[model samples]
Target chain A: MPQGQPAVVPTDGLTTRQRRNRPLLVLHTGEMKGKSTAAFGLALRGWNQGWSIGVFQFVKSAKWKVGEENAFRALGRLHEQTGEGGPVEWHKMGEGWSWSRKQGTEEDHAAAAREGWQEIARRLSAEQHGLYVLDEFTYPLHWGWIDVDEVVTALRERPGHQHVVITGRYAPQALVDAADLVVEMTKVKHPMDAGQKGQKGIEW
Target chain B: MPQGQPAVVPTDGLTTRQRRNRPLLVLHTGEMKGKSTAAFGLALRGWNQGWSIGVFQFVKSAKWKVGEENAFRALGRLHEQTGEGGPVEWHKMGEGWSWSRKQGTEEDHAAAAREGWQEIARRLSAEQHGLYVLDEFTYPLHWGWIDVDEVVTALRERPGHQHVVITGRYAPQALVDAADLVVEMTKVKHPMDAGQKGQKGIEW
Candidate 1:
C-alpha cells in the first residue's frame, strides 16, 4: 500500500486499465460514525469526474437536513448553472419515494423501504447514475425489511459502469460477501465516551 | 448511538447544549482508503454551518490534483461569491508553503512539513478556521519529520471552537489520546485485492 499502490497484483487476464476502470460495489459498515460521510465523500469524487451522483438516504428522517445535502444541492445547482460537474439527485426514504409519502406504522415503514429498494433497482437496470449512494441502507436489510438475496442479485447483475456505495451499521454478511470493497469504521475513541454530546456541523 | 444520541451523559457540569457545541479534534487513521475522504466530508458539514474550512495536504505531491481539492475550491469560490458558506483555504506541502517551492532532497520535504505545522500552529492560535483538515498529516509524525509531542501540545492548548481533523495511517498514540474522536478505517475488502489497479475519479 505504499504510495497508494495495490499490495498484490492478480494474474487476471484483463489489462491493467480495464481492471482499474471496473465499477465497484463499496460497502461501509460498523458501529461508528463516518459510514455515510465516507460514502458522500466518494460521491464528491464521482461528481468531479462528471459522473451522475444519486444519493438515496434510507433511514434518516425526511425533515432532518444533513450538511452534505446542502452542499450537494449547491453542487447540483452549480452543475446546472455552469455545467462544471455532473447532475445530482438526492432522495430520502419516505418523502423522496412517490409511493411512500404518508407516515404510518412499522408495516408502512417496511413497505416504504421495499418500494425504495425497488426504485433503486429500476435505476440500476436503467443505468441512471454513475455513482449511487445508498446511505443508511443497511438498516432496512438488517431489519429484514428487504431481502438481502434480491439486493445482492441486483447489484451483482447491475449493468454499465455504475458504482454503488452502501453505508450503515450491521451490514448483512451476504452484502459484505457480495461487495467488491468493504470498510468497517471502528471507533477507537469518541467525545461521547467522555460524555460530550453531538454538535452541529460535526455530527450532521 | 441510537438516533445519534450520546450513550453516556457526563456529570462534568457543562450544560447539554454547551457540551454539544464544544469543538472537536478528530483523527482518522489505519490502513484504509476513506480516511481523507471522511475528513473532507466532515469539512462539508462544517462548511454548511458557516465554519471556515482549511485543508493542508502533507504527504501528497503538489502536482497531484485530488478531486476534493477541486470540489472544495469550488466551494470556496461559492462562499466568496454568495456568502452562503464559510471561506476555504487549501495548502499543499511544497507549493502551498511560500518557503519551499523548489523540489530538493528529503530534508527539504521534511522542512516543508515542519513549516506547514508551524503555520497551522499560528492559525490555531489565531482561531483561524472552524475546521482544519490536516490531510495525510500523520505521515509527517510517523516519518519523524514533525514532532508528535508538539502537535499534541498545540492541539490541546488551542483556543476557541476551531476543530481539527488529521487523516492518515500510523497515527501516533499521543495524538490519538489527545483526540476527542478517532476512527480507524479497516479494510475488509478492496478491488486491489482482486488485482484491480486504482482508477481516476474513484481512487483520486
Candidate 2:
C-alpha cells in the first residue's frame, strides 16, 4: 500500500480486476530478521479475511514453543469455537515429522524435508488452503534437500485462488524468479551490535 | 537468533543478563511493505510473553478496518476474559485524534500530531507498556510536525524496560542513530509490476 502505484505495468492479456485477484507467490528472503514474522503477519491478514490458513515450519524444533505458534494455535481454536475468522493448521518438521519416524541423521532429515515438500505439493494440487505459509522453506531448497526447479514448477502451476508465501534466507534464484512479490529484509543496525543477547519472547 | 554471536561485544561493564534485559528501540523504514505488519507480529510475540502491548497508528484512517486491528482486539479481549496473553491498547490518529477538535487543515493535523507525540511521551515517562508500537510515526518527524530530537531523547531516557518500535519510510537520521535495531524493507519485486492492484486482506 505504501507504493501507491507500480513503476511499470506489463501488457498482460488479463484485465485489471483479474490481475488484482490473482493469487500471489510472495517470497521473503534476506540475511536479517522479520522474514518469517512478516509472513505470519500476512497469514494473519488472510485469516481475518475468512481464508483457511496453513503454516509449515521447516527449521525450528517442534519442541520449541514459539510465540507465533502459540498465538496461532489459540486462533485456530477460536475459529473452531466461534467461527470468527478462519481455520488454521500448523505443522512443523522438526521432531514431529508425522510422515516418518526416522530422525537423527542428515539423510533422514533430507528425506523428511522431501516428504514435507511432497505433502505441500499435494495440498497445492488439491487447493487445500487459502494461504499456505512455508516458514523457512527456502533452507531445504537452498540445501538441495528439495529440488528448486520442482518447487518452482509446482508453485507456478498451482491451481485455484490459493496464495503461497515462503520465508527464509538464501532463496534460490529460480524460486525468486518465479515469485510475484519478493522482499529482502536488510539490517541497518541490530541490538547485538551493543553486546545484547537474544532474550525470551523477542527472539522466538 | 539468526546471528548467533554479536560481531563485536561492547565493554560497557554491565553484566550479561543486564545487557540482555536492556530495552530496545527498533525502527523499520523503507519503500517496501511489511514495516508495520512485522511490528504487529512482534507485538503478538510480546503479548504471549505477558507484556502489555500498545499500538498507535499515525497514518491509517481510524475508520479503516485493518485485519491486525481486529485480530489484536480479539486477543486483547481474550486476555481480559481468560488472562491468556497480555493486555493490548490500539489507538489511531486518523480522524479519531481526540486531543484536538480541529480538522481539515495541515496546521491542525500538525498540532494533532504534536499532541499525539506528547501523549506518547507522557506514557513513556509513566512506563505504561512493555512494548510500544508507533506505527508510521516517522512521517510526522519527516513532515516536521514532531521534533526528532525530542522523540529520541524521550526514548533514550525512558525508564523501565519498555521496548519502542517505530515504522514508516524516510526515518530521520537522528532517530535511526538512536535506535538499537533498524531494518530497511527492500523490495526485489512486487505484484504491482504485473499490473495487480492492492487487494483486500493482503493490503490492509
Write candidate 1's Cα lDDT for A88-128 as tens digits: 99888754464457656443677789999999999999999
Clashing residue pairs for model 2: none
Q: What is the clash count of model 1?
A: 0
Provide the fnat value for model 2, as a fraction from 0 to 1: 0.73
TM-score of 1: 0.94
Off by over 4 Å in 2: A96-107, B98-107
Write model 2 residue lDDT over A34-97, tens digit each, in one string. Answer: 8887888888898899899999999777677778888887778888988888899988886645
What is model 2's C-alpha RMSD?
Answer: 2.1
Worst 10 residues of 2 chain B by lDDT: B98-107
DockQ of each: 0.68, 0.73
Q: Model 2, range B67-177, lDDT digits (tens) per residue?
A: 888888878888898899899998888764645535665545677788888989999999999999999999999999899999899999999999998999999999999
For residues B1-204, what per-residue lDDT tens digits would candidate 1 score against the true structure? 434567787887999888888889999998988888899899999989999999998867787878888888888889999997789999887554644576464447787899899999999999999999999999989999999999999999999988999999999899999999999999899887787777777777
